[model samples]
Target chain A: MAVASDTIAAPEHSAEGRSETIAFLIMTAVLIVAPFFIYPLFLMQALCFALFACAFNLLIGYVGLLSFGHALYFGWASYLAAHAAKVWGFPPELAILTGAATGAVLGLVAGSLAIRRQGIYFAMITLALAQMMFFFALQAKFTGGEDGIQGVPRGKLFGLIDLASNNTMYALVVVIFLACFLLILRIINSPFGEVLKAIRENEPRAISLGYKTDRYKLVAFVLSATLAGVAGGTKAIVFQIASLTDVHWTMSGEVVLMTLVGGLGTVFGPVAGAFVIIAMQNYLNALESWVTVIQGVIFVVCVLLFRRGIVGEIAHLLRIKL
Target chain B: MFEIFGIPSNALFSQLLIGLINGSFYALLSLGLAVIFGMLNIINFTHGAQYMMGAFMAFFLLQYAGLSYWWALIVAPVVVGLFGMIIERTMLQWLYKLDHLYGLLLTFGLALIIEGVFRNYFGSSGLPYAMPDSLRGGQNLGFMFLPNYRAWVVVASLVVCLGTWFVIERTRLGAYLRAATENPTLVRAFGINVPRMITLTYGFGVGLAALAGVMAAPIYNVSPQMGSDLIIVVFAVVVIGGMGSIMGAIVTGFGLGVIEGLTKVFFPEASNTVIFVIMAIVLLIRPAGLFGRTA
Candidate 1:
């Protein structure tokens, strides 16, 4: 009877695995082809946010940790990358690495402090710390204060391929996003990922099972922060700006909105969310605060009746992983 | 001029008064948060927005109804408190079954909507609320000067804080609240309407924030973004004080405010972040908070 039950569960697992891979392939194809029809700038922005949201999802979805202040990581990286590119005259890729390193260091400090508290306190601690950084950025000289680091030269790729053209920059962004996305996929399926899920499902239980859950959480946080930095750094190169807006609490809320709208725990939810939200902001730019109002409504709606989100619901209906 | 630690007495005293005023706001705000969290088991993220609304309410009362500061002080919180009750009944109640984080998220969304709407209508600039005819002047305390309105704010805040503390920690009604806080399910079995209590508790807590807002209008510019900005600092105050105790919240709120004021006088660059720094240090030394007994 036990073997029969296990066999049935095994087929369900295989089906989910198969569907997940299929979805990723479809997503990849769409991402590659989407730029042809859509405006590349808008597409690139959405992709950066998508990658950012995906990194955010890795912590919240897999580890069940909702970081309310991810903008710190995203914004700090953008600033570092922009400063490195413009001032240090580094190559584009090296600038991005510098940004990622900065974010990792920040994550180490922030994650260490934040992990000391649990649940709601954790969210508040991250927010307060981020606010502290925001104040720091406001006072610090290198960030250019309110004006931010503007006119950041995209420079060359590995000091060879010129990236001044929009097309080259777009392609580079796409490639970097894909690479990071795949790395996220790889991490999510690893033993480390399983332990993260275990910790998320029940931290006390995971701890009882001899897992140093804090270390796992810290590692996941650093990974998530580094990737978010990658997205932010690339964004700075693409847009040639890194400003206070990126580090603001509103930006943090925006990422959370994207994750919530797409699907909290699904593979492709952040991608869908980023596009939908960015598209809304893009088209509704004339409407100003209405966009904010609309986002708020979506948040309320998402929390109340539709927690599964667009991708999660679709995945659930299809009996497949997203 | 006399000097304390090489700083002039006047500068120190004036800054201390500023800190006390700031701490009063923090105390009032954190007190509301603690009250709400005690009963609802959810941190009120919409608190800042509601406080902003309270200021707006007072502004509207003065502009449209020709109400005076005293009238707005009495009326604004009541009006805003009702709105809070509506939100509690309609929205926040639904989130009780889920993780406490959802409550934070929902309130945060509400805050965005409220602030966005207000920003759309009024813009981000601060609107000055005129002081009353009786409270326009200042008093010389020999070494330092004190504005009448500022002095009133400190006194009024003290009354409210102590009144709340007295009611909650002393009265018979307080016993019921304590019972509900300890175990709602057990209390509900004794023929009490626990859900209604929860809603009212949320409303009362929100009312305290509105009261603070009404008080704050004359001191700070009544801006839409005011509450959201202050709330983060209040969160740090709550963390440092430990949200578990009313007295803890009040004491820490005022103490940190003083500390922040002193930082401004000594190291102005660090003024904005000193509270957060202290919060970090507190988390390291006492993860639960100074007064917090539980995790």
Candidate 2:
């Protein structure tokens, strides 16, 4: 009976896996072809946010940790990257690395403090810390205060390839997005990821099974932060600006909104969510606070009815993973 | 006036008074959060929004209904608390069965909607609420001047906080609340309406926040974003104090406010972050908090 159950589950799992791959392939193809039809600037912004959301999902979906202040990682990294490029005269690649490194360090400090608390306290702690950082950014001289470090030069990717043109920047963004997305996929499917899931499912049980759950959580947080930094850094370069908007509590909420709308645990959910949310904000720019109201309504509705999110629901209907 | 650490006595004393006033709001708000968390096992993210609502309620009453500050003091919290009860019934009750995070998310969403709507109508600017005729002007304490309205806020919030503490920690009703939190099923089996108690408890906690808001209108700007900003600091206060003890929340709230005020006098740049920094240190030194019992 056990063997029969195992055999039945194996093929279904494989089918889900195959569907996920197909979805990724299709998503990549759409992203590649998207710029020609849609505005490249919008697409790049969406892709950066998509990457940011994916990094955020790494912690929330897989680890069952809802960080209410991911904007700390994304926003600070953007500032650092822009500063590095514009002030220090670094190449784009080096500037982005600086941003990622900042994310890792901040993640270590934040993760250590935050992991001390469980559930709701964890969320609150993250938010408070992020707010602290927001104030710091507002006062810090290096951050340019309210104006932020603007007019960041889109230097060469590696001191060789010119990235001034929209097409080149778009290509570079797509590459970075794909690379990071795949890395996240690889991380989630690894032995490390299984333990993360184990910890998430039952931390005490994982401890009983001799897992140092905190270390795993910390590592996952760092990795997530690093990727978020990459996205933020790329955004700074592409947009030629890194401002308070990226680091604000609202930005953190926006990332959470994207993840919630996309499907918390689904692989493709954040990407789909990022695109939808970014598109809405772009189109609804005229409505001002109404956009906030609409986003809030979406949040309420998503929590109440569409908990599985866009991709999650579709995956469920198709009986496949996304 | 004498000097303390190169700062004049009057400057220091006035800042201390300002801190005390801010602390009063913190103490009240955190107290409400602790009560709600005790019963509901959820952090009331909408507490901030509700507080904002209370202030807006006071503003609306005074503007449209020709109500006085005294009338607002009595009326605003009840109205806002009733609204809180409606939310508890319609939205919050549904979330009790799921992960606690959903409660936070849902409340956060509600807060966003409320703040967004208010901002749309009122814009980001603050509206002034007039001080009651009963509590106007200031007093000279020889070293520093004391504003009567500010002093009243401190006293009122303190009375409410201590009164709440007495009821929760001393009364027979408090025992039932504690019992319900421990085991709702057991409490319900004993013929008590646990669900209604839970709803009422949430409403009461929210009312406490509204009361603080009504008090705050005279001191701070009656603006939509005020509550959200203050709520983050209150969350840090809750963290440092830990949620396990009611006294912890109260003490931490007031203590942090004083510390914040002191920081402003000394290291003005760090004033915004001193509480958060203390929270981090607290988490490191005593993960369970100063007064919290480790679960």
> Taking the tens digit of each residue's C-alpha lDDT, what string does model 1 give over A267-303?
8999999999999999999998788888888888998
Worst 10 residues of 2 chain A by lDDT: A1-10
Q: Could you give candidate 2's per-residue lDDT for residues B128-164 as a string of tens digits?
A: 9888888998999898899899888888888888899
Candidate 1 Cα errors over 4 Å, as ranges = A1-11
Task: Report the lDDT of model 1 for residue A13.
Answer: 68
lDDT of 2 by residue, A152-227 (tens): 9999988888999999999999999999999999898777987888888889988987889999999999999899
Steric clashes per prediction: 0, 0
Cα TM-score per model: 0.97, 0.98
lDDT of 1 by residue, B71-94 (tens): 998898898999999999999899
Error of 2 at B234 (Å): 0.5
